[model samples]
Structures are given as structure tokens and as C-alpha cells.
Target: MLVIGLTGDVGGGKSSVALLWEKEGAHIVDADKIVRELWREPEIIEAAVTRWGSVILDSDGSVRPQVIARLAFSDVREYRWLCDLIHPKVMRRMERAVFASNRWVVAEIPLLFEVGVPWWVDFVVYVTAPPDERLARLSSARGWGEEELRGREAYLLPREEKIRSSHWVIENDGTPEELRAKAAELAEMFSFFSEPIEVTVSCGSEEEARRLSKAVIDRRKAACVHVYPIESLYWWKGNVEEDHEWEVSFKTVLPLYPDLVGIISKEHSYEVPVINMASVVKANRDALLWLWEELSGEPDNHAHRS
Candidate 1:
């Protein structure tokens, strides 16, 4: 399973990117949504009323988030107090979501670095756009005045700092279609495993191994393939057997697994060829980006995948 932390500045389209990943079978754990549910808890509303003296309540006796935000962000001490009261519980929920399944998961935590989310996240994806573009989007879509936008922006870390800490960057300065393309790439980048899969196939001779490996790379199904000599020992027809064989390993994405297997099965010289896969688990970001470029027929940026 891969756990990716998705975050960005205000109006940078973090939700849009998250939606794309969700469409690709990634479970989205939205931190803002979790906090919204917490607001409706009776105990939480009661606590807010008790501490803030009913100023943060509504006519129907519910907590008013707008009122609370105005109060909390106005004073450093008040903000810390509010965070202390709710962050621990919210973090617990976030942790549960990360470990809930053995599939790709994307957690949209707007304050990922500020709140110090778990370090176990496989990688961080920071969405970005020009300041002017973000400001325009906030004004038109969110109806936020310049002053309001500045107020929110002042609370977050600088864009350069966020980019420095991120493992991947997604630029959201273009049209929705362009952003969707980036989102789809991101979804594929983190699906199933953060690093590429190492698929190994045993063959009767080096000729067969080399041929299969060349075919995979030529078809753009893998970034690279290696063939090596090896000895195999396994039970067959109720008898243990030992034989010299060649192993070919291909580095590729999970979505291409079925295709790689099919090709190897068709090209093998044995009745039942041995094929298996192993996860890379972790690797250099540049290396992964290089692999993606090779597989996608993109020009080599080498430094970044975006």
C-alpha cells in the first residue's frame, strides 16, 4: 500500500487532484471533511461552548465554525488552545484511514506540514500555481476578498518552502483539462506502490531471457530489463528437481503487470515458466521519474516528474 499526502496553498486545486486519484481507485481521506464531522459531535459542541462562553454557538445550539475561526486566528494563544483541543482526535482518525486498506490511499491534509502529520506517509505531493492565479481563483470561486485571501495565506508556509519539502510537484496554473492530465499522471505514479515493480521470469536459456526482456522494453511496458544466470530448485510432478536457468527481471508499473505477464507467458520456452514480482518499496525520486519518462515516451526532465 502507498500512503500519499496531498497538500497545497489556498485555491491551488488540491481537491481537484484528490478527485482524480479517487477516480483511479485511490481512497481519499480528506482532513477537512473529518473536521466537519467532528463539529457535529455533541461533546465537541459542548466543549466549544464551555470554553468560548457561547459566542461560538448558533441559534439552534450548534457550534459555528466561522465564529470559532474568527476567534481562533485572531490570537496566537487561542489558536493553539483550539488546536490542542481537536488536533489529537483528528490525527487519530487520519492514522486509521491510512492503515485501513492494502491499496493506494491519498490523504488531503491542507495543514500537512503545519500539523506534523505522521512521517510514515510514503511521499508528499505539493500542488502549486502562481500567486496571481491563485488569488484570482479565490476571488471568483470562493468570493474571498484580497484581505481575506491574504489573511489565510499569511498562516501557511511559503510556497518555495513547501516545494522544497515535497517529493512531487503538480502545477495547477492551466485549464481544468491540463490539471486533469497532471492528476491522472499523479494517480498512476502512486498507485499500488511508490516505486516500480520488479517482475522476474525464469527461462530455459539466456537467449529466451534476452528476447523476452528486449520485447518488454521495446513495447514500452517497462523502463528496463535485466537477464542473469541462476540455478532453480523446485518440486514438479511430485519430485524435487534442480536445473540451471536464466532469470529476467523487468522494472515497470503495477498497471502494466498483466501485460508483462502475458508477454512472458507467450514467449517462454517451457510448459510452466516461473514468473514472480517484488515491490521496490522505496527509491530515489529522480530514478522513479526517469522510469516514468521512459515508459511514457516523455522527454527526460530528469529532475522532476511534473
Candidate 2:
């Protein structure tokens, strides 16, 4: 799965972008939701009471996030202490959610860069809007004035640095439809390259390997086929056998696996060819995009033998 780190300045509409991706079938690991859940735990509540007293609790006996925010944001030392208490737990939960998901995952972490990018994230997307627009959003959404917004943002990494570290930067100054379009485009691209696989087939000879590779490419069964010489040893018919062979590896997505196997089986001379598939956990974006483009056309809608 492709894991994306989605972050942005306060009131920049990162959550809106995440929702769009979710609509496109991506799983959203929302950090704020996780934080709220953590805060509701008994141990966390007890710890909060110890640190800041019972005044942080609501009438319903739940921890008031706004109360904690107010107290923490007012003092740099208090803010750091609060983060120290909360961020590690949040990181663990976020990693668990991201790693457990099979679908394309979008992690909506507002302080992603501040806490450091997670190792599992494949890419980072930084959302931003014009200062005036962001200030307006903060005012309308959180009852925060310009000074308050600026004060809170002071604790974050600079906007320019965040943008520089990101793989994709989205400007949320446009209409919601425009922002949604950007999210949709990214979702599609990520989904297309999500499950890359490397199919390795052993051929009896270089000539056979070349022929099979050519057929696969011509039919668009795979994005690319690499042919190389190798020595092999195997047990066949109760005897050990050794031979010089050619290895052909196909770079393609999992959806095209059946087609690739069919082409190899049909064109190969070996009765029981060595066909092995390995999942590619990571790949270069440009190369994967090229692979996707090469095999973008519809697959053959026909049956194939084992």
C-alpha cells in the first residue's frame, strides 16, 4: 500500500483533502481523532489531572482539549511537556493504523513535520493557503484572531521548510471543487502504483527468454522485462540437475500478474517453468508511473491455463 503523510498549517484544510482521498477509497488515519481517543482513556485522564488538576475536565468528566490547549499554548515549556506526554502515544497509534491497512493510507497529521516524518510514509503532502484565507478560516472555525493563530503557529516548523520537505504541496486558496480535484488526482495516481510486483521467470535459454520478454511487452502484459544470464540447480525427477539459464523479471502491477503468467507459460519451452512473484514494497515514483502508463490499457479478457 502507498502511505501518505498529509499535513499543513492550522486552518489550511488538510482534513478536507484527507476526506476527499477517503472518498476515493483510501483509509484515513486521523491523528486528531486518535488523540481524542487517547485523552479519554482512564490512565490519560488521571495523568492529566495530576499535571494540570481537575480544572481541565468537562462537566461530563471528559478531558477538555480546549482547556489543555489553552494552558499548553500559553507556555513554551508547558507545550513541550504536553507534546512529550502525548506525541509518542499518537505516533505508535498512527503507525499501527497505517501499517495494518491494505488500502491506500492517508495519515492526516497536522504536526507531521514537527514530530518528524514516519519511516513508513512513502510520500508527504503539504497543504497551504494564503495568509488571509487561513486567518479567516481560523477565525470562523476556532474563534481565533490573527494574533492567536500566529502565536500557535510559532511552535511549528516554518512554512517554507515544510513545503521544501514535502513531495507534493497543495494550495487550498481555490474553491473546494478545485481542492477535491487535486486530491482525486493524487488518489488515483497512488492507487495505480499501490501494489507493484516483480515476476521472475527462469527460461531454458537466452533465446527463449528474449522471445517471452518480447511477447509480454508486445501484448502489454508487463511494463518491462529484464533478461539476464544465471546458473541454476534444482531437483527434477528424483535427480539433481544443474544448468546455465536465462532469468526474466517482469516489472508490473499485481492486477497484470495473470496476464504475464499466461504469456510466459504459452511461450516458454519448459513444461514447468520457474515462475516466482515478489511484492515490491517500495519503488521510485517516476519509474512506477512509467510502468503504470505502459500497462494502462485494458487487459485481455480471456481465460488462461495454470
Candidate 3:
């Protein structure tokens, strides 16, 4: 199971990214929702009353989040007190929810890094958007003033540090379609929608096939390459042609298919290499592991995308 902690600046579209993950079958545990529940808890209400007296409470005697925020943000000690009072309860609920989730769990923790909860996830995905855009979104969506937004944002770590700390970064400063595409790409890493690829690349001769096979395997492009002698019939230019050929089948992960195809084309003698690939819907776990381990040697610059 893969546990991904999703976080971002307030109003940076982390929830939008999380919705895409949810569509891909990820069990989403929203920390904001947990906080909302915590706000109404008797213990939290009592704690707020004890700390700030009646001012932080509503006429109905419940703790008002906005009132608490207004008081807490003005003083560091008050802020810490509020966090200490609520964070433990939030963590307890988060743990219970996560324990009952599916194989792919995505917890949307807006203050994931602030609360130091990244350590609990397999990896953290930080969503990013321009400050102007984020401020606009927050103002329009939640009716927060610029000063109010800035005040809360000031409490968090720097944007650059958050991006650096996270294992993956998703930029949400684009259209919804672009964001969805990036979301899908990131989803592939968790193997939620991942499938094996069978790549076919033909060679002029058995020697050429063996050389191609060896090169790809040694380079960790393919876990297993099978070279077979075969007769190929094809239409070239204006005439149908038949000749002896060698077929090379590369068993690899879907993510490596494009690279594998490029490698085959670069090594092939033919001007137009017979490169084709199809997804393997069901494959043995050991075989999949071998392919993954081989491809793991490659540098993952795309792992922490912006």
C-alpha cells in the first residue's frame, strides 16, 4: 500500500489535486475535515475556553475557529497552545482513518509539513501555485482578506523549503486538464493504474538482435529480453517484401516504454524499426519486481516534478 501525504500552501489547489487522486481509487483522508470535527469536540471547546476565556467561544458555547485563529495568530504562544491542544487529537483520528484505508491512500494535510506529519507517509506530494493566484482563490472562495491570508501563510515554512522537503511536487498554476494529466502521471508511480509493457523491436539478423538485447538489459532498460528468429513480410515503398528477421521482445514497466522504444530505434539497423508495445494487464509479481528493480537504476529527475 502507498500512503501519500498531500500538502500545499493554503488555497493552492491541493484539494483539486486530491480529487483527481480520489478518482483514481485513492482513499482520501482530509485533515481539514478532521480539524472541523475537532473544533466541535467538547475537549477542544473546554481547552479554548480555558486558554482564551469566553471571547473564543460562540453564544452556543462552542469554540469558534475564526475567533481562536484571530487570537492565536496575534501571539506565538497562543498559536502554539492552540496547536498543542488540537494536533494530538487530529493525529489520533488521522492514524485511525489511515489504518482503515485502501491500498492507495492520499491524505490531504494542508499543514502536513507544518505539523511534521510527512514522516508518517511513504512520500509527500506538495502542490504549488503562484502566491497571487493562491491569494485570489482564497479571497474569492473563502472571503479572506489579503492580510488575513498573509498572516496564516507566514506561519508556514517557506515555499521553496516545502518543495524541497517533499518527494513530489505538483504545480497547479495551469488549466484543469494539465493538472489532471500531471496527477495521472504521478498516480502511475504508485502502481494504482500501472501495467506491464511488452515491447517488440525487430532486427536485421540474429547477431543484431542479440546485441540489441544485451545493450538494453545491461543498461537496465528491460528486465528480460528474448531474441527469436522469424520471417518478416512487409510493404516497403511500392512493393511487398519478405525476408528473414530477428524479433526482440522487451519485458518492462510501462513508465520505461518510451525510453525502451528510443533505445531500440537508436540501436536498430533499419531506418524504420518495427517497434511496438502493448500493456500486459496481468503479470507475475516477481516479473514485475525484476522490471521495476532494473529501471530503478535510472536517475528520477521527474520524481520531484514542479
Preferred candidate (lDDT higher): 1 or 3: 1
Top candidate on lDDT is 2
Q: Can you give the lDDT of residue 116 in candidate 2?
A: 88
Candidate 1: stretches off by over 4 Å = 59-61, 101-103, 128-143, 167-175, 181-195, 204-220, 223-233, 242-249, 278-287, 300-306
Off by over 4 Å in 3: 193-306
lDDT for model 2 = 0.85
On TM-score, the candidate that comes out on top is 2
lDDT of 1 by residue, 59-118 (tens): 888787778988887877888888887887888998887777556778899988878858
| TM-score (C-alpha) between model 1 and the true structure | 0.76
Which TM-score value belongs to model 2?
Answer: 0.84
Query: By TM-score, is 2 or 3 better?
Result: 2
TM-score of each: 0.76, 0.84, 0.66
C-alpha positional error of residue 187 in candidate 1 after TM-score superposition, expressed in Å: 4.5
- Cα lDDT tens digits for candidate 3, 66-134: 787889899888888878887777877887888675456788888788888744476688988888898
**Candidate 2 lDDT by residue in tens digits, 155-205:** 988988888888788888899988887777677677777888899989988
